[model samples]
Target: MAFLVVSRYSPLFAILFVASLAGLHCESPGKSPAFSFRFERFEKNRSLDAVIALYGDAEISDFVVGITRPAVFSSGRVVYRKPVRFLGRNPSFSTYFAFSVSSPDGGEGLAFFLAPSSSPVKESTNGLHFGLPPGATAVKFETRTEPETGSHIRVEVGGEISKQSSNLSNVSLVLHGGEKVHSWVDYDGDSKRFEVRLSKSSDSRPLSPLVSYPIDLSRVLQREEKLVGISSSSGNSTQTSSVYSWSFAVKRGAPYSMHSEPLDPRPFVVRARESPPIHLRRTYPWGVFVAMVFAAACGGLLTFFVMFVWFALIARRPVAPVEYPVHPVEVGYQQIELVAGEKGVDSTKK
Candidate 1:
């Protein structure tokens, strides 16, 4: 690792040297760019474990030492469902997602990384460095308002930037939370070349690779087990972004088509969402149902009140006794006895 760096930046200088040692080919950044499938193409189960932060909260919601806000020392990560397939010969893997960032002065920026899985996602002391985990390879996307520096891309391998190989130039595109920009990272197993592309639209890939490096994965990856995901950070500078969608895959058959595009980009068509980050759809119905129940309860109370008032009014009046007429065809026995007593012993004689 120490001997790989012998000089200053030159076109494909570091890449050539590195690839030679590893026995791989890295394409130049100026070459024709193409490749990668959209994330929407995958099913829901593709996710292994996700540790990204949403709404200023982290994927691990119950933790005390996790990131909870933007523009702070924060980073987010999403581990693939399984170790990316590698034959230990030549391997190809890709991750694509659209991100939007907003910062006033300068933000530390976002990073794409691969690291070992621990009990919990590691948090860096500073956001500018993306709380870089040990043995991690990361590519950072800095915003124009980074507190310490201007906007640019910085690549870190093994927790340190290879000054001789890293690019420290400003990108022309303006990034914010409103408008999303598409980014693609593709590692060609055939060439052992890694390339990245960024664009404003998913209908098209970037015209050319933003940065290209020749890395032989079979050498760097010790075991077949590893993690692939993204992270971002900000110190004093405030920033915002979202991982709206993402996808990853391992090849077993043929080399992927160098030129393949989706028939329908569907920029206007909103696909049936599998789920939303924060769901209010169900809450809407619950609210309506609760209100209806409350209304019915009030109506019942009103009816009871009206009936009570009617009873009070009725109580103020006196109720008259009802009389029944009776026929005296058969004289009351008491009356007959009274007559007999009046007439003396007449009843006894009868």
Candidate 2:
């Protein structure tokens, strides 16, 4: 009966083995391609400028380069230009190219803006290059020296600079030491607004919100126009600066709607999708497998021995006899009736 029971359930082991193989066959979905760019050097002397033509209709310009002189004395200078068109029908946007720079003296810094003309401007005296024209919404992140504030970093939105804190304030976002920082401005079509955010690779913190403003696409210039590139400068004090890389992405028509309604979308499939089966041909190493098998067998044998000993102890216990012994006194007190019977027989005989 035990053998029949074991045989009846043996197929379940095969089913579990097949289920494990099936689990490994499922694969993850694909992902979109990442867009990026890197620039080794950008200098007015080098005449290097990076440009991104947006869907062939608009252009985003970036100026990146090193400066020999600082912004204080006006020895170092950088400039960039590209043709752009804002037809007043499509949304056009611009930002100072984001880059990482290390200065020997840490004197002056960088800027981003859209100029009436394509020519590059000199580094401002009070870090004013970041401020945009009147009625223009712009944000600037600057790190420099101040008379009352000393050395600090900040973000300027619409020419208003927020107080500096170790935490990410309104302008400059805190980046983890030893990691790159990235920030961007995005136009959302569904919301019909522009949103700005900053991100750091080393920090796991949530994106820092700069600001959200309405997009007035009609304000942008029409016909062919030039887009400005990223620029940086040092003060009169000698210092070397460099920009590693920068890039931009633009969508022509209305901004794509990224929002989606929540749905399970799982039970609607009718056909069972087939996939290439995973093949697991390799087994444990011969020596280790043999050792494991031997150890398991020894463990099972030990258990059997323990059970046999327990059953033997229960079966061999001595049991008491049912009858009791008669006392010597009772035996000695036996009646003399036997003798009386004999005497009667003798008198009859006499």
User: Candidate 2 lDDT, tens digit per residue, 1-350?
Assistant: 44453465447544644654564452222211112122322222222323321110111223333433333433222323344443335543423133443444444544443334433233243323432333222334344534454323443333554323233433444331213445444554334565544454333223434555564434433323434334344444333333334433333433323223221212111223332111112234664666566557556655655665565566566677899887766444433333347446332221
Cα error of candidate 2 at position 118, Å: 5.4
Deviation of model 2 at 202, angstroms: 3.7
User: How well is each residue in 109-144 modelled by candidate 1, as lDDT tens digits?
Assistant: 566776665424445445555545577767676665
Stretches of candidate 2 off by over 4 Å are 1-64, 67-80, 94-98, 103-108, 118-138, 144-179, 188-192, 201-208, 215-217, 221-224, 235-241, 254-350
Model 2 collision count:
13
| Candidates' C-alpha lDDT | 0.50, 0.38
Error of 2 at 282 (Å): 44
Displacement of the residue 225 alpha carbon in candidate 2, Å: 2.0
